[model samples]
Target: MSVTTTTPETTSTTQPKKRRLRTPYFQVVASLAWKDLRAEARGREMVNAMLLFSIMAVLIFSFALELDRQAQEATVGGVLWVTIAFAGTLGLGRSLAAEKDKGSLDALLLAPVERSALFYGKMIGNFLFTLAVGFLLVFLLTVLFNVNLFRPVLWLIIVLGCLGFATTGTLVASMSVHARAREMLLPILLLPVILPVIISATRASTALITELKTEDWLPWIQLLGVVDFVFLLAGFFLFDFIVEE
Candidate 1:
């Protein structure tokens, strides 16, 4: 009787399965996002800059308006969204610029990771940072402007706004990172494109804060949802072209 070992063949068959388990789309994106989060947690350079810029911008806008109670409420929408845009742009630009400067982006691209997964990872990382600043802005806007900004609908607007902001901002940042003046170039490319999101967010937030009827707020919220969807879709499809260059 010849004793033949089938263990090698069985191990070879299971090898592919093990590899497949490690490379699921969600897991890859999670690992990539976690890499960024861990790095940020250790140094905190990006989050620190974003928070500082947002806080100062909000305070300046509050003081500059110099409005009466009614006037403050009227201008709050513009003030809040504008502050988030500024801070988010700054954060997005620096985050990608830092990656490009260190050549980590190239390494990330070289990995056997899906392009869409890479996009989501970067998009989620940017969104979390931007969202943090947005929440802080909400708190500051409430205290400084003496307006109630922490409503269910208003929080929804922040969620949608940050989602749209991060998607568009990340796409633009990847494109601008190779430019000579990426910090300057990022806003030029980013702000014009994200106008719809800003408008819809501002409108929805204003209506919610004003205690408008449900029907009135829903349309703007729907428009915000549409804008966020469009940008996120664009980022998902276009990230390959931008990064693979």
Candidate 2:
């Protein structure tokens, strides 16, 4: 038998290849988020459903209420938050459920990565999808309600609000995915938990939309940020346990 020889050049090349398999934590997060993003871009299933729902909700509300200019400005915040909350819930459930159905979730679980990284990856994908719906809703509201919803402050609130919703939603969706009635169960479990965030976001958006004083809207915005941080912390600490089950 020929003797096995290990050259320095071969050893160095082989070692780097082995190390490459040990992916960095953030790289894992990016890869996972990118995977979901690519799948969503290719399929367009989740985002399209969410967009349709958002559009219908905006149209139905606008037609049903027939709000005057003043009324539109005043009520637009409520409409925006309600649409985001429901649509985000739909996207979140679909994201995780798709993984489960495809057996991809099991493979992800078996990968050499921190569970929290997985949570952040999933949360980032859900956040971006929901944020896209939120932006579309803003544009639709502007066109349909004849209100200018392009205020810098309002967009900031939407970002923070969607961030909070996605953080909490990702965790809850994971928990509900193993259930038979996950579609039903996710919202039931999620809406109640996310009610506080929705309320804060609604109040903040309403204040800003109605052109209230800084004192009026600032408190609500601050509260929204705090709630978002709490949820983020909760997801960070709790997601590992959730995925394990």
For residues 100-215, what per-residue lDDT tens digits would candidate 2 score against the true structure? Answer: 99999988888878888899999999999999999999999999999999999999999999999999999999899889999899989999999988999999999888898999
- Kindly report which residue pairs in candidate 2 clash with one another: none
- Per-model TM-score on C-alpha atoms: 0.89, 0.90
How would you encode candidate 1's per-residue C-alpha lDDT over 104-141 as one tens digit per residue?
88887777777878889988999999999989988999
Q: Which candidate number maximizes lDDT?
A: 2
Superposed by TM-score, candidate 1 places the C-alpha of residue 72 at a distance from the truth, in angstroms, of: 1.2
* Candidates' C-alpha lDDT: 0.86, 0.91
Count of residue pairs whose backbone atoms collide, per candidate? 0, 0
Off by over 4 Å in 2: 1-21
Model 2, TM vs. native = 0.90
Top candidate on TM-score is 2
- Which ranges of candidate 1 are over 4 A from the true structure? 1-22
What's the lDDT of the predicted structure labeled candidate 1?
A: 0.86
Candidate 1 vs. true structure, TM-score: 0.89
